[model samples]
Target: MANDGLSAGAAARRLGVAVTTLRTWHQRYGLGPSRHEPGHHRRYTVDDMVRLQVMQRLTAQGVAPAEAAAWARRSPGTDPAPSDAPPSGPVAPADSPDPALRAAAAAARESILSLVESGAMIADVGLGDARAGGGQTIALGPRVDPAARGLARAAMRLDGPSMRYILESAVTHRGVISAWTNVMMPVLIGIGERYEATDRFIEVEHLLSRAITEALSIVPRPPRELTPRVLLAATDEEQHTLPLEALAAALAENGVPSRLLGARVPSRALMDAVDRTGPAVVVLWSQLPGSGDVTQLQHLLSRPHPPVVVAAAGPGWPLADLPPTVTPLNGLAEAVRVISTVKA
Candidate 1:
């Protein structure tokens, strides 16, 4: 991310690709350098380097050049979505774009940005150097909120206080759903992809998750006098509950009170809790395929008086297997809106 920019050879060297390869990317994909001087070849700016990095990484992961270029072009500061409904996927020179492909690439970029610069940023989570590092920094790319940039830097450094300050400030100012989706989700997903690709930074994930849990928990709950009619639990062995936590916090913010069964609730235990509480709505979360058995949903419906709404929330559940009686929640905002009505 050198501000002065890098020449073709230097940029190619940094990317470990031959200069001809760089030329091919530039000529064919519109990924050419933007920085220029009188009587000199254009140089690669920091933003251009970022796009090239995405191109290099995606191509390395077996993505085709045209497809990768679609992604590289969409990244912040390159040619951003300038409309109310942003376009996604790699844009081809002559053919129509693919939504699914573009979305996946964008999601992957959002998820892996932090880990891409982990080696240097992970140790110095501070506000001052949010933009100081050269190559080893979280890549929120251009057009990201400055808060997210700071948070990503803090997360890479694992500076708990700064992260908490930034996260809490975001949640306080923007609310849980916005903060989670815009701030936390990107870094969380980014670090996760890093782990998937490199099998490292579990510590970063653990610390960040803990910090988020703590911050969200501090959001004041509804008055104790209000009876809890909504129940939330993760399916047995499904340990990913951050989304559930966000849902809980969002609901709490909007004045809906509910019981949260943190994680790993067996079918019997879930059923027992539902049977005992007689909740109006029961939200079961499953974060992985192994624990997302539909039999649990079937078992819940078998109860003499199953909760009025049996909501299956999370990506873990098999979509085809979910019975017609159950509700599927795809995001925190939707979950809160749907559950709030039943409880009200």
Candidate 2:
């Protein structure tokens, strides 16, 4: 028979905490299962699950345990009626979006991107001198998602906590692709444009990249025994590893483990790694035209036991010059699909 309420293990896994953590929440915080049936152990009801989510979100934001517990306790098994919504107290501003909207944005924002993409503000505002009184701002297209807006604001202030919270929530709920394309990409591209126009805020880019890397690393990988058949690496001396990092995390979420060689792999080192691991597919990434050379792909294809598929990915690659034997992957979704499926 199908399970009715979630088991402690399942709930813990879903929430990305240990069973012990769940137990503590149950025993100490009174956030235990409410669905009781004959004989078997108590199970977590939907209401209990909702409360736990509130607890998890608050704690991750660094709220003191006692205070977070109070908030969780105050959360009704269901959201309050529109008029009955509880007071904001001091945690959030009175005008902040409702928990329901925030939760919805947190859950999935593909539609949000679509909605925002409809506006004229999103009118491909090339990055430039968009500024507030004290700080330089990146121009995200007019039709920006709320989460993206929040992320941009956090990034501008160099607020690591808020950036981490936004990114982690997106990756955890919507998976890597949606998080990357909708939430991360807009901000990233916006920043890149700003850098192009003003050649400033290099620190902001570095910090944001660090936050993204940390958040993506949290996606659990497949079992250790499952050998990684996919390999990802940046070109020699190329420091743009974020896109490749996103691919790795996306693959892991789908249970496809990969070996990432990280930034700046020269031909000799890359070949040594390729010969050693013998990946089924090898994706070489280049973020700048200077780094993306056709010969790098040629070297892979010439290997004695070359991977069945050697794909050139990123905007840097000169797609026209690449040989017919190489597959060209232009985006994260396509890269994940191609790398995960290629035969040895």
Candidate 3:
């Protein structure tokens, strides 16, 4: 049956809260169900579901339910709005995209490009002169081209010292992982290409890449909790283990016990692991285009007994032909949110 309308049990399940909590909201807050049937069964609609979701999000962010409810009530027909503005304030000013800032960005890009094309190390030129007030020394690196790197660096609102610190930290960290890969990788790649195109920052790209890889390594995975058992692995030809590692870490953080099988596991091995562990969920990492043996995967997914939830992460996921039961994980945050919702 279509679940467009929610019963009390279903609503509680969807909200990730106890049934009693939902009842309390109805009684105390007057956020009652939309309708009551002849037998006194409460029914909630899509609007009610959305309101609950907004309230849940706000409450999770440390807002009191009463405040969230008031905000929701005021907003009415909209999502829950924050009671207060962010301390950092609004994102853009009336005169944003300030002319001076844009010009500086352009000049920085040009400078880096010129130096890189001429075989000069970006770190040698130093970002110190790029500063507005000539207050501090700025150092660019060999891995990125200067001008383009400078523009990107400026955009990030990072100082030379901070950039240097990030680069040094990356050297110790390791490789690209899940949400980081999705959110940061694309931006980083763009920065690198811009530097290359402008001939501004050869060192900047290299330094940034190294730093990101290092940072990934340094971020410790959380200790596994004794919750529902889950197994994680990557498909054959999907040698990137970072996403799986990240998912495992997130799962652990959420108190979902998980074991990582690492990269490039064969189909039989994956099946065997599932058989041996009898896991509730089997997370598979594959950046779509590069994944091999899809047919084998499809066949294995058809098996009965030991119901499994398959989660696919990375670039190739959208392109891959997945079974009806499989879930495409867009990024690290979404993955964690989904897992938590499932657990709840």
Candidate 4:
């Protein structure tokens, strides 16, 4: 170590986080460097690095940033001249009163490394196969966000609280669209691929889906004054509803109210819903090809008071067979943009 202290770049490099993240920690949470050399920029002393390591570890374990900062600020060993290197790994808050935090701390380092090495920024890192880690890890590809890594690790461990924390943080901080597109989708896809290849991790998939649904449902809905002119449902025999859930949440984020009929809506029932609600927009989701019958879309179009927009979503739909009036929604953002702008 230099006789002075480490610059911000050096500190971020050592900690495996983006320089902007460190700047956020410094500006918002007050976990900034303390050592100011003669005429150079303030640098992170060994003690400052220790606190940040604690901060990094806790946040990676799905702890909220403000709470993690509070813990980091009070972390022991802030006073004395530190050793040449920061602690080799994350330092747990042993004296914490919260048992859940303590439990998470106990396994945070190993769990973080399972999906992301040394808790580094996720880029071009080939996290090994599930079999390599005793079926407790899922690999996300290059340039993925750290929240995705945390969620993947939590999903593998079946840690509901941590998974919820990571997911909620993503949704709250990044908004529903960014959260769904960046953080949640990647992990979900990785797990789906994992299940397909090995015929395993069904439990993992179920739990993660439940967590995502729970997280998305908490997005505050638009006021009742604005009637929900948008309707969402899955086609007959289509049990997959997570994407629809995400769309609902994203719409809510845009202050657009929507009625979500959930999974496996029969053609008759969906028609009945459309008739009763007279929704301006109706989105039918189909996750598998067999479930996406073009006839269903035809049924909606034939209604006496047909919707302004009848949309088909998910990979199951046969684009060529879709009714001429039906709008094909390729992704969540596009679905939101199309549905939220419809005239009643």
What is the clash count of model 1?
6
Worst 10 residues of 1 by lDDT: 121-130
lDDT of 2: 0.72
Cα lDDT of all candidates, in order? 0.73, 0.72, 0.51, 0.77
Better of 3 and 4 by TM-score: 4
**Candidate 3 lDDT tens digits, 1-344:** 12335676666654445567666566544455665568766676545544554444334323446654543333334332222222121222323354432332233334334444564431212222222322211233445333333334432333333333333232223222333543334436675466656666555555554444444444445553454567778887787675566566556555566778887888888888777777766677876576844554575576675435666667765444666667777877787777666641
RMSD of 1: 12.7
Each prediction's Cα RMSD? 12.7, 16.9, 25.2, 12.5
Question: Model 2: number of clashes?
Answer: 4
Residue 45's C-alpha lDDT in candidate 3?
Answer: 50
- The better-scoring model by lDDT among 2 and 3 is 2
Q: Is candidate 1 or candidate 4 better by lDDT?
A: 4
Best by lDDT: 4
Sort all candidates by lDDT, best to worst. 4, 1, 2, 3
What's the best-to-worst order under TM-score? Answer: 4, 2, 1, 3
Task: Give the top-scoring candidate (TM-score).
Answer: 4
lDDT of 1: 0.73
Candidate 4 stretches greater than 4 Å from native: 1-135
Q: List ranges where model 1 is wrong by over 4 Å.
A: 1-136, 139-143
